[model samples]
Target: MTLDPSVVTAFTPTGKLRASINLGNPVLAKRDPVSGEPCGVSVDLARAFAERLSVDLELVAFDTAGKSVEAVSDERADIGFFAVDPLRAQAISFTAPYVLIEGFYLVRDDSPITRNQDVDQPHNRVAVGKGSAYDLFLTREIKTAQIVRAPTSPAVVQTFIEQNLEVAAGVKQQLESDASRFSGLRLLDERFMVIQQAMGTPKSRGLAAATALQRFVEAMKTSGFVSAALERHGIAGASVAPAA
Candidate 1:
């Protein structure tokens, strides 16, 4: 793919393409248990983008999506992987989502809320990661239940357990992993939301860069690169998003 020179400049101002890797979204990026390096579908995508640009790949790691968004907004990173959230769109321009991950609620096995619909009630506190897609979504959609913000997505499970929250909202895979690690935690079978994971560049990067990224992402999805990366990384519970 021949990229416009300006697009390259917009995405690699420091001569290296710094991609923000948010470990908070475990489905997208995670720490390799053996190597302690960032690894996952998002990491693979970032590496692929860098190679396509013929630039060095720099992983700018963060613990939360908000921080990753902030990095791109601040021009500290060239691109970031994010769940398409309207609140975040002001600072960054996003490609159509390349992956879809479900968002679910985790509640105690013995809790009264057995169904997803039971989560919303007066006095029911839902623990969520502050500035997360779910947090932003729930902040708007949830009319009755109160939301308690955790420091990060990975921290939500612990916050739920420690604080005895009525519901814990996060990525389904994450809640499943947490349920296995912590007994008595059960995820609602029904999902409340689908997270649209996409790549983003600072809006200030200009239209050329944005268009280039969108094309790159769609091509990656259409050609099966994103699916291959997910399988290679053993990622579960996420599907390749259809073309925009």
Candidate 2:
């Protein structure tokens, strides 16, 4: 079967890459908001995988990271990039995390919420991508603040910039890229989750596929290919675990 040279996105701005890439406009394109390109660490990792796969990276952008999983589950792309969790494990397998991400509270940089406790104030609102690890984390941590669920990381950034919300929750890398746009927006250093970045395959084929995917990830980690890929993408601080 011929490989389909196509890309699909779940967000609006459509993340762009430098190489000969197939672009899929999704609802969530995390940007500098000022630079207007793919700015998150996730984008970097995804592009690196595309390069390694030797196929034109087909990014199926989603308004939120949660929606991106659908693309992988549907077989639209060979895999997807996201923070892995047990709930997602039931749907897809993940690669070893490349970066150590901690939970952060995003708010206007000038706001008094420079710390975690500040966000617990009544009437404080925080935004999160629906079904994202951050979203899952926030639902557990920030029960006091009203939660605004955005479709994509970019949209959540936009909402904060547009003054539609009070705070946001996500990884530091993503929040940092987005905060660069709204200088007024800043990330609170208090982190919550210990997430590892991994690729996912649909849980449909049962143990064989799951086993295969896990092995592929393990091989990538052990062979140092995964580290090389992360470095190529400008994502540092990731090391692969030995295959068990």
Candidate 3:
């Protein structure tokens, strides 16, 4: 796909396509165990987008979603992979999601939080990754429970365990992995929310560039690129989003 010159310029103002990668989201990105380089579905998408624009790819890596979103909003990076939230949309133009991931709640096996609804009690302190999708969502939806934030998404379970919090909130796959490492932890049977993971550019990039990105995401979803990347990276518990 040939992108317009203006669109290319918008995404490559620094002469390279800088993609803000959040290594905290294991499903979308992670450090290679051996190489320690960022690799996963989001990395593949960033590379493909850079190639489409015919620019060199520069990964601006961050350990948290908040930092990644900040990079794009501040124009330190041209694009980023992020969970779509209304608060984030104020500064970034997001495409329709390319992947859908479930947000689940975790608790000790002996904990009384048997259902998703049981999590909102006033006495329950829920641990979540600060500035993560779960954090953003729960900050609004959780009426009575108090939210305690960990440094990053991967730290939520640890924070919950350490602080004796009543619940932990995060990605289903991530929570499952964490549960396996510790004893007596279990996930609630039902998910609390579905996170829409999408690609975004700074709204300052203009309507044309934003529209081009939206089209690119739709094409990626329709052509099996997103699905293939998920499988190639051995990502489970997440699915390719339907075409927008």
| Best candidate, lDDT | 3
Q: TM-score of predicted model 3? A: 0.99
lDDT of 3: 0.95
> How does model 1 fare in lDDT?
0.92
Instruction: List the global CA lDDT of all models.
Output: 0.92, 0.58, 0.95
TM-score of each: 0.97, 0.67, 0.99
Output the TM-score of candidate 2. 0.67
Clashes of each: 0, 24, 0
Error of 2 at 156 (Å): 2.0
Q: Between candidates 2 and 3, which one is better according to lDDT?
A: 3
Best TM-score goes to which candidate?
3
Candidate 1 lDDT tens digits, 109-159: 888888878888997999999888999999999999899999999999999
Off by over 4 Å in 2: 1-63, 75-78, 95-99, 236-244
Please give, for residues 1-244, the per-residue lDDT of candidate 2 as tens digits. Answer: 1112232122111243212111221211244457666644446545754454344555455555566766666555556666677766766766565445566677775677777778876789887767777777667777678888776555677776566688887666667767786656666776756656565655553455445445555655676766665566555433444455
Of candidates 3 and 1, the better by lDDT: 3
